[model samples]
Target: MPRMIFVNLPVADLPRSMAFYDALGFVNEPKFTDETAAAMQWSDTIVVMLLTHAKWHQFTDRPITSDGSSSLRLCLSLDTRDEVTEMNRLAGEHGGTADIDPPTEYPFMMSHAFADPDGHIWEPMWMDQAAMEAGPPAQTDA
Candidate 1:
């Protein structure tokens, strides 16, 4: 089978989380959504599962931590820099806040971070293909 990744994140509320992700242009997969879990599919290999705190805790023994007052960050890349800024603006309009100060203009790459409804950070990044080709091979965990 092809490789796949399912990122499970704890959310305080399902509906609000759904709305937040919707604003980010992520389509929710109803087939995998329920009262406790909302599946946000970015692509074939990228599946982000937004699960309620209680539901998430059921899968792990560790206590679930509230996102409030926490500065942890989560990063996700995009295809273009315009998409990054657009998502950031859309996120802010839909109750998400920019995690970073402002847009960073670079010759090769661009990035901007945003925090979701529950203060969970999300970074949208873009790296120029030409610049990447000029550099070393990208690193991967596997």
Candidate 2:
């Protein structure tokens, strides 16, 4: 069986967070959703579990961190630079913040970063493995 990942995050508002993730192309698994939590599927093997603060505390004794104060940032890869741009646009359109940083273009990859409504940072990126293995391109004047 293939390994899978389920990233669990604490959200202030389950519905609002669900809406925000939906805009970013995740489909909610209704069977796993309720007032206390939502399971958003990013791919066949990847899901993000959004839990209410109270529900989250039931699993961990650590204090809840406020939005924008989180230590971990989630990153997802896309097939093309265009997809990264589109995801960032959707995030902003659905009440999230885009332009966490200007889009970056290295010889091998391109990326855009944004924040969800709860201020959890996400980076959507595209990469060319061939270019990456070849190493960074020689510097040139802008």
Candidate 3:
């Protein structure tokens, strides 16, 4: 089986978070969803599990971190910089908050950061591996 990523995040309100992600067009995997958590499928193999704070703790014995004032950020990449902007915008429109700073621009990458309603920081970015390898933006001959 192909390696899969399961990003487990803690949410204050299960239903509200579900609605927020739903607006962004992520389908819920009912087989993996329940009252305490929901399995959000963003792609065929990438899965994110949104769990209530309590449920999150149940999955582990370690203390759960309250996102109220944390400075940590998690980055989720996308195919294009435009998609980053769109996702960050939609997040804000649907109860999430965009990062105070504007999207960052570099030679081969662009990123827009934001926080969920509960203040968990997330960055949606676009990075071209080939372009990055070339260093800086390539000069096209067109």
Candidate 4:
């Protein structure tokens, strides 16, 4: 079987978090979903496990951080820059915060950051495959 990544997150509201992820294009896997947790699939290899505080606590003894602080940001790669922008728009419309940070631009890439209702940061990005394969432009002296 191919390796997959499951990002588990502690959410204050399970239903709300499920809805938020649904709005952002994740499909919920019913077989792995229940009252305390939901398995939201982003791609064939990526899944986000949204768990209630109680369910989360069952897995860890650490305190749940409700303070808008994050140690890492998850990223979703799209096929086009417009899709990245659309994701940010959907996040804001679905009870999440959009544009938590300014958008980033590069000769071959574009990205925007947003946060879910629980303050989980997600960055949507687009990159030109050909440009990436060619590597970054060589640095030049001013």
Candidate 5:
């Protein structure tokens, strides 16, 4: 079986968070979803677990952050720059904030940052593998 990554996040509203992810193209995995938590699958190997404050507390003693601050940022890679832009648009159309920061662009890549309703940051990016491997073009003094 292929290795998988499960990211668990504490959310203020379970349903809202699920809807936000759904808008961004994640499908809910019913086998791992319930009233207190939801499993949103981004890909076959990537799953995001959105848990309510109470449900989150059950797994850790740490305090749930109420402020709009995030300790970590998550990223998702897409096939094209257009897809990255579309993801950001979907985030805003649903419930999340779009373009928390200006979009980043390079000859080989593009990225846009967004924040979920609970303030978790996510960046949707696209990269040309061949160009990335070739590295940035060397600058020449004119």
Candidate 6:
């Protein structure tokens, strides 16, 4: 079987978080969802586990980050730059926030980011396959 990744996030409101993910094109996997936790499937291999604060603490003693503080950001890849833009737009329209940074475009890729209602960052990016095959772009002085 192919190895799958499950990125777990702690959310203050389960239902609201579920809805926000749904808007960003993730499907709810009801088989693993309940009042306190939800399994949002972004792809066949990527599933995000959204757990309420209390439920999350059951698994770890570490405290959840407060609003406006971020430890890490999650990224999702799309097929095209337009898809990246559209997803970010939808995220904002569906109770999330966008424009965390200006969209970036390189010779090989394009990307944008948004934050869910709970402040978890999601970046959607698109890369050119041919450019990838050519190898990483040359490093330049800052």
**By TM-score, who's the top model here?**
4
Q: Number of backbone collisions per candidate, in order?
A: 0, 0, 0, 0, 0, 0
Better by lDDT, candidate 3 or 2: 2
User: TM-score: which is higher, 2 or 5?
Assistant: 5
Candidate 4 clashing pairs? Answer: none
lDDT of 5 by residue, 15-63 (tens): 9999899989999999999999999999999999999999999999998
Q: Tell me how candidate 6 scores on lDDT.
A: 0.91
Q: Give the TM-score of candidate 1.
A: 0.85
Q: Over the stretch 1-142, how does candidate 3's per-residue lDDT look in tens digits?
A: 9888888888889999999888766789999999999998888878878999889888788866674676578777798888988999999999998765688998588998888777778788899989867777656999
Better of 4 and 6 by lDDT: 4
Please provide TM-scores, in order, for all candidate models, with all chains considered together: 0.85, 0.88, 0.83, 0.96, 0.91, 0.95
Off by more than 4 A, model 3: 133-142
Tell me the alpha-carbon RMSD of every candidate: 5.1, 2.7, 4.6, 0.9, 2.1, 1.3
Better of 3 and 5 by lDDT: 5
Query: lDDT tens string, model 6, 1-142?
Result: 8999999999998998999899888999999999989999999999999999999999999989866887788889899989999999999999889988888889689999888988888899999999878989889999
Distance from true location, Cα of 94 in model 6, Å: 0.9
Model 5 CA lDDT for position 49: 97
lDDT score for residue 47 of model 3: 82
lDDT (tens digit, per residue) of candidate 4 on 1-142:
8999999999999999999999999999999999999999999999999999999999999998878887989999999999999999999999999999999999799999999999999999999999889998799999
Look at candidate 2 and tell me the lDDT of residue 89: 94
Off by over 4 Å in 2: 132-142
Model 1 lDDT, full chain set? 0.82
Which candidate's lDDT is highest?
A: 4
Give the C-alpha miss distance for residue 24 in model 3, angstroms.
2.3
Clashes of 6: 0
Model 3 clashing residue pairs (backbone): none
> Could you give candidate 1's per-residue lDDT for residues 43-118 as a string of tens digits?
8888889999889888998876663565566667789988988989888888778644576668788888878877
Candidate 5 regions with alpha-carbon error over 4 angstroms: 135-142
Candidate 1: stretches off by over 4 Å: 67-72, 136-142
